[model samples]
Target: MKRYAIIVAGGKGERMSSNLPKQFIQLRGIPLLMHTIKVFYDYDSLIQLIIVLPANQISLWKKLCNEHNFTIPHEIVQGGETRFASVKNGLVAIKEKCIIAVHDGVRPLVNRQTLENCFSTAEHYGTAVPVYAIVDSLRKTENNTNFAVERNQYCIVQTPQVFQSSILKIAYNQTYEERFTDDATVVESLGIELNLVEGNRDNIKVTTPPDLKIAEVLLSEREAIIS
Candidate 1:
């Protein structure tokens, strides 16, 4: 089956308190986004990759790739104001009808097994999302005060969320709405049910400064063990 990945890396990294985009930040001496892309390449070297970068920073990405000696064949899509728009642009760049997986560029630790399962499920199902069951205590809040709810029904969703190319294309063709949190949410509006696959707990998306520190610790620990 033909498979492609759209790595969304357009955010300005304001929360990260860095002048550089968060995805361009280094983790274990590799760009965070590059590490995320490598996971899929490691799983299957042939899987196509399309990186959605901020329009203003596209040249920086190209320069970074050259500086790092990173090489993998992929297309570059300019990011939009919103994540959905960026993904839609990437989807438009794809020429074939196949399974396309949307992954957060900041999430560099998703394992091969999870990806294999997600693709395997997406082949039969029209849509698939990797999710980990919420293990923390249930909480409902109003005005920063906590209430209670059953935690059993909740799961923390992660990427790469896979979907049939045609289905995803149609989903993006719809009118833009702020309600669309993720691609799955947009596609589900078209009457598609999202199939859930088990996710790796370590597959965290680097958002805040603390997340980067955590990723560094994990990567360093892994490297020490390997060495």
Candidate 2:
């Protein structure tokens, strides 16, 4: 089946304290979003890439691509007011039934193995969501009281949330709701159970300045391994 990735990168960078969107910020010597796109391209040259950006930022993104000489062919779609809307916009651009991976463009460190696993699992199960086990203590706050909970009961959800295109398309047809935080949530609302897969710890969504530093370190470590 054909593979497609809808990379949602509509951040305005207010958290990163930068004028540019977080995805446009330089990770090492390249834009973070470029690193994400290149990795998926490297994974499978046949995989169709669709980038979703804020309507006003599309021109800036194009200019950045020209300046960087980044010529990997991909379609750019305008994002919507909310992430749910943004994803729905992306789903509209897909006309064929295939495997689709909805990913955060800021997550530049999604390893090849994780990508392969998600797609392969989704192909079989109709939906796959990458998650990492929570290793820290957890708590539940109610009113002014706090109670301890089992950390193992919760998992950290990561993206490249892959699903059959038809399932995702059908899921997006529901009226937008505030609780639809992620693609998995949207699909789950349809009574579809999600298949979970292991996610690499390095697969982080870069949002703040500290996240940028962590990504730089992670990239350097990976390069060291390659060298």
Candidate 3:
């Protein structure tokens, strides 16, 4: 079966306090989005990659591609106003039946093992999302109040949310809601249970200056080991 990944990027860099969008920030010498796209290509060179970006940002992305001499093949589609609509637009771009992965553009550190876990699991079980065990204390907040909750009952969800393309397409056909946080949640609105897999601890979403520094260090270490 064919494999496809939809890399959704619509960040405006508000949290990072930068004028540039988070996806275009330099992780090493190149734009971080390039690294995110490369990992999927490294996983399977044959997998089709579809990038969803805002209409205004497409030219900037193209300029970056030329500047860095990046040559990985992928399709670019204009995103919608919200992430849900952006994913919907991405799904529209898929014309064939295959496995589909919805991933974060800022999360450039998802390793091949996790990709293997997600794609294969989704292939067998219909839906898969990566998650890490929460090691911090849990809390629940009510109106003007807060209380402790069971820490063991929760996990931090990450992407590369994989699904059979049919299942995903049907799920995305529903009306959008504020509760639809990620692809997992949007799919779960169909009452389908999500399959969870162990995500790499190092697959951090780069959103702040410190996160960029950390990713640079981690990626440098990996390159050293690989070389």
Q: Model 2: runs farther than 4 Å from truth?
A: none
Q: Write model 1 residue lDDT over 20-49, tens digit each, in one string.
A: 888998888878988888888988899999
- Runs in model 3 lying further than 4 Å from the true structure: none
Q: How many residue pairs clash in all the candidates, one count each? A: 0, 0, 0
TM-score of model 2 (CA atoms):
0.98
Q: Give Cα-based local distance difference scores for all models.
A: 0.90, 0.95, 0.95
Tens digits of lDDT, candidate 2, 97-207: 899999999999999999999999999989999999988899999999999999988999999999999899999999998899999999999999999999898999999
- Residue 202 accuracy (lDDT) in model 1: 88
**Every model's Cα RMSD, please?**
1.6, 0.7, 0.9
Q: Candidate 3 clashing pairs?
A: none
1 against 2, candidate with superior TM-score: 2
How many clashing residue pairs are found in candidate 1?
0
* Reference-based TM-score of each model: 0.95, 0.98, 0.98
Cα error, residue 158 of model 2, in Å, equals 0.2
